[model samples]
Target: MLTYNLSNIGSDSLYEHLYKCIKKDIVLRKIKPGERLPSKRTFAKNLGISVITVENAYSLLMSEGFIYSLPKKGFYVADLNDVQPTKQVHQETVVLTSGHTHYLADFSSNQTESEIFPFTTWIKTMKEVLKDNQKELMINSPCGGILELRKNIATFLKEFRDMDVKPEQIIIGAGTEYLYSLIIQLLGNDIKYGLENPGYPKTAQIYKSMNVHFEYVNMDSYGIDPQELERKDIDVIHISPSHQFPTGIVMPISRRYELLGWANKVKNHYIIEDDYDSELRLGGKPLPTLQSIDVSDKVIYMNTFTKTLSSTIRMSYMVLPESLANEYYKRLSFYSCTVSNFEQYTLSKFIENGHFERHINRLRNYYQKKQEIILNAFQSSVLKNKVEIYNESAGVHFLMKIKSKKEEKEIINNAYSKGIKLNPLSKYYSNSIENNNIYVMNYSSLNSNKIEEIVEKLKQCI
Candidate 1:
């Protein structure tokens, strides 16, 4: 008979507790291989629980190859020829979904504040889209996403970014990570690729995972050094030109032209312009995209709603040159669009009705004020004399050069121990080029009400 103290299940459900207890016994061979499990009713009576709970536990065990069932013969433990004991892992990792401890001042996260989302307006737009697009919602989106959404995006780009692109030239996917995979397949893996050193880590991680041949090209003060690309004989170069990550250096017009000229010289040379947070630029008009200036069809432009909209949106898109767009359809049209029809229709209506634009305007104002509050807090902090802020105008994050003699790793660890998560600039680099004593401070998600406490925590970290 199977029995467990049901009263001590704690937070777990009865079935779940029984499942774990039985699984543990089976792995330990206390419930031997080929041993018959008690009938659901009998086990339920033994443990003083419902028959459904016992049945649920048995079902889970059978599903996991821990046991087997016959029509009338009942459940029996499977032969345990190769099951191994579980290795020790962090308790929090097993129990908590986020896997990291909450921090008082999390300068490592770039997540947008949840309060900034216009849920009322968004839900209203979704309802409107549902009411109007019933027939369209039933149909699957095309490989390049729905025509309506693409059209709205194209119009938005022209009006805001000054880039004239046709709907056919855009490709929508679940996220930038998915789009990067498509880019790799569209552009042959045989070519050499260049990524900016000390750039976004995920970009490098994606290229490496896909078995792509890529090199880290060092950046000068302006942005990616075109002269280095020439020296490296790179084929495809990925850069965040409008506002570079961590450093927040916006590419000068001269450097943008130089990169375009470099791409023009070679037959298949191309540049990938990742204009991630251009919409949230705090000062002046956003910079014109490199694609808008490229006459030779050498730039593939990419952006994501994860910055402007909520991170949970999982929507991103790219603008391909006309030639590449044709090539993409020819080579990869069989794959269906990754986003759902409902989301596409809703977002299309949201953009077409000006809700998205209004939301972005509101968000820009909110973030600008948040930035001001945090900067003011830092200015008044005890560590104000020990830190220098840089590139505070553009993205949600910027660099803070700390005047400390401690090694970067030691400083970061000290901060983490004090509930302040800090990410050093040196950690982003792949090569030996050192960027010491600087940390990237992402403040978009910081709680403005806790600014004083957060500043005190930062003071302690320093």
Candidate 2:
């Protein structure tokens, strides 16, 4: 008889207690590989627990790879060292099912609402580009990008952003992620990268995955603190000064100059300015890029068409310093990061014809209207006293700071159950133990009706 003490189990649920006992034995290697477990009925009877409890524990053990079952035989301790663990392919299936169900509102992504997309105009432009640039599409262009697109980008920057960039300085790639990845590889290793705390998680995840040393610089209402940055010995700083993600706080000109001064003081250091959504600034005059302020060739500016145009475009470009541009071309000579020639040629013509400007103006006006609706709805809500909105004047999303953190999950769950999805503030933090009561709600995807409904539902939840 295997002498096992049952009196020590303290869990309220018999199955949970039994599961832990077997899992502990398996982990400690006391239950040798391929050792058969007691039959479910026998084990349950011996322990004075229901048979279903033992079966449930065994099923869980098998699912988690702690044990295995043989045909018409019994469950045994698994040889974990040699076990081919099952991939979690089913995890996404459940999420997909839940996502497809028609919801009253969804404020998750920073994308323009489905109804706002200029589908007809885009299709017309795409067809024209394909027809006129068919010959260019047949062959591969330079890795840096087609000359026409580069020239158009330069002109666009000059007219709109007051950026004095040339075609030679522009390098086109699929998206911002790809462009940033190239920078990481080109810059080599052993350099410290700095990111904004409570900023875009993707930026942090990519750097960490590359095994790069990085620090999170704390952010304030004015954006990332330059004084705090002086304390850390960082080689590069990545910032989204135009419209900071999640918070939507724009960096003031004084701080921008200060940051530039910091980079100038440190020799060979770089700053990556991610102008992800600057084109959508509704009220004030659009700010000049950090690259434009670079007197010392310290800032590398990158922007994407993903936000302004459409996500499917897969087009983004960077304006590199003359020194860096030369090095990049020489290093990436064999590797091609150029987009499709047809698409580039089409986009060039689109901008040259002034459609791009008109498109941006239309979107600016549209977003302004949506922003107004959101502001009005929130102001009149019952939860107005309990929650205060931040970053409402700009960007696609706004942050709602609650009075307490206790109801954070409750509110999220209630909203989710009502077909409204929200991202909790804690989700954005690397350190979750910190007390944060903010919730990020994107208005870009919500229509006026959806926005009103969402606000009313949120009021009830609070």
Candidate 3:
């Protein structure tokens, strides 16, 4: 039987805390493999917790594959022999009771402006989908997602990204995270991957969670330095050539060709191009995707509508090369599409009827106005001389380099003390480098009335 002291239940929910404690024990190998856990009622009686609490904890553990149950028998521990054991047992104890409402203005987030979401347009389209395609709602999405949606996406990519990909090469998934895992499975496990150093840390976290061996490729003025790729013996590389996160540097055409040459010369090497926020480019014409110029078919293109559309929509897709697409069906055909038939059909109609394109155009104009408002607010403020904005013409966020006498942590702390949330640029780097005072000032959440106030408060902190 398992044992734990339940007398001092702090702020966390009783069941969740209990679940974490048991999960920690399981990971630390305190309980032996295949050990039968005590019955929920017995455990509840022993620990002075509700039986329902115990049941919920057990259910969560079972869901996460930490334990298994037999119909006639009790629950038993799962084998963690393959799981790379960690020394630290106790996880972060402080769980926030309140949500993100604690912050006054959270500029750290890159979420789309919810105020501009096309709710009425989407609702009308969804109603139409329900009225017309009643059969689709009851069935599962196609193995590669609804064929109509895939066809519309292919057409959109041809016009929006200038990529000539067939519908068969595209696979729709729930989100970027899901697609990342599928890619890992599609490619063999014996692979060494590389992610950009000052890139989205979620990518690295996902790779680490899956026990993937990945390295951080350092960046330069343009993008991921080609020399860094040559230096490391890597099998796969994930990058955002069009509008890199936080940095907003579009890889020039020359650097892109250099990458293609590198992939072509090397055998069994591929590039994962994450063009996540490409549709939101403000002023200039949309840049050509690297997948467009790849005659050798070594680039795996990925994009997500979650950023452009509502975050809750959770629709992302990937475009694999012809060979990889064939290999996927040969091996991964058993997997059903992560998205549902109803939502997929609605999205198909939305794209087919020219609504998605119009929505994107409206967002472009909306974000451009917001961008100008925030930049002008900063320039007019007293801190204007101290803050240098970079790559403001492109994405929803711009890099704000602060010329301050204080260190990065000190500046961030001061800002937080004033109820301001700051995303320091140094937090993104996994490698040891020079201390650069940069902050990612996101304007998507910027309120025109509060822009001056936020800038003023930041001025006081700096």
Candidate 4:
């Protein structure tokens, strides 16, 4: 018979406590391999607990391969001789990583602020999903994603971005990076890709890893120059028209049409509209998406929840052109959906319940206030006369032109040594360029309270 002091179960339920206790004993060799466990009823009576508790514990143990059972016989501990003995780890000794340096201010990361996250709302929606969507959760999502999520997203795009897209056109993926690979596969590798110069580096990194032919397309004032794309003879161009990264250039309506015209000129031409971080547009009405204006079926629209929700969510999606959508199913239908059914269903409920929009409204207000506070801090800080801020109208980050004689690299390295992480604007450029003293001020996850301290530290570095 298994012996456990059930009186001190603490926060755990009757079955959970029993399960952990039994598992620990089995792991420690107190319950030897092939040793029979008392029947559920006998164990329950001995422990003064319900038989259901013992049964559940036994079932859990069996499911985890810690124990086995024979029909019409009894439960027996499974052989764990090959498994190493569990070692107790001290809390203080268990560091997640070695030599991990903590930064006072990480201006390079565009991670969402944890304080603004609607944890209570998200948790409630998730719980509701677990209770109401047990069946749907078990069902395998289609290669694109669950219909529920896609449908909600479709409706959202229509109302928010004025894009008329069918749910069938949306293909959900783990992240924008994952979807980029899918795009390369969908549109053969032979074609040349025109990437925005001084844009997000991750896109270029993805293309390089895939060994695809690509060139850096220089950007004019409007955005990625269509003339540059034509000059490069590029078949595919990746762009962030709504709000260009680092530069924060929102492509004008004229530019959007010009790019679409260029795409229409070539039979194989396609524009990957990476509309990342458009939701957090700080001021004025949200600009229309390129997909909403696209008529030539040349746009492959992509967006992610990482901006509005959390970065760890790993949920992103793309809207394929009608023809491309058909082709995707014909060619890539065998690929199972990358996101889990539970997440898909939970997001669907989040959107359907109006929590997403409300959260967005609240977030926008919070970020607007936060951005003001940080900008004001910089303006009033000791570095007030030494810094020039630009492109603070939209997005979570802006371009900061630091008035310094030191090179960008030197300034960045010195700042890092002082516990400040500064990402230089030149790092996004593919070709080598002289130091401009410009840095990308990503304040999404910045601690506003530490702004004064950071400015003082940065003063020492610059």
lDDT to native, each model: 0.86, 0.78, 0.84, 0.87
lDDT of 1 by residue, 1-462 (tens): 666776556546567778999999998999999899999878877876556567767778876789999889999999878667689665421222353335667888877777888889889988998889899989888999999999999999999999999999999999999999999999989999999888888998899999999999899899998889999999999999999997899998999999999999998999999999999899887778999999999999999999998878999999999999999999999989999999988899999999899998998898899989988988987778989998878878888998877766556644654557787888788865454789899888788999888778667656
User: Pick by lDDT: which candidate is best?
Assistant: 4
Error of 4 at 46 (Å): 65
Per-residue C-alpha lDDT of model 3 across residues 1-462, encoded as one tens digit per residue: 678875454544557778888899998999777999999879977876556567767878887778899998999989978568679676544433333333556778656556788989999999999999998788777678988999999999998888899999999999999999989999975889999878898999899999999999888988987778889987899999988877878898999999988889887889999998889899788678889999998999999998788777899999999999999999898999989888899999999999999999998989888888888888887877898988876768889999988877666655664557788887788975555788888767666778777888888888
How many clashes (backbone N, Cα, C below 3 Å) per candidate? 0, 0, 0, 0
Flag clash pairs in model 2: none
Clashing pairs in 4: none
> Candidate 4 — which residues are off by over 4 angstroms?
1-101
Summarize candidate 4's per-residue lDDT along 198-269 as a digit string, tens digits.
888888889999999999988988898888887889999999988898788898898899999999998999
User: How would the candidate models be sorted by lDDT, starting from the highest?
Assistant: 4, 1, 3, 2
Better of 3 and 4 by lDDT: 4
**Pairs that clash in candidate 3:** none
Comparing candidate 2 with candidate 3, which one achieves the higher TM-score? 3
Q: All candidates' TM-scores?
A: 0.80, 0.78, 0.80, 0.78
Judged by lDDT relative to the true structure, which candidate is superior, 1 or 4? 4
lDDT-wise, the better of 1 and 2 is 1
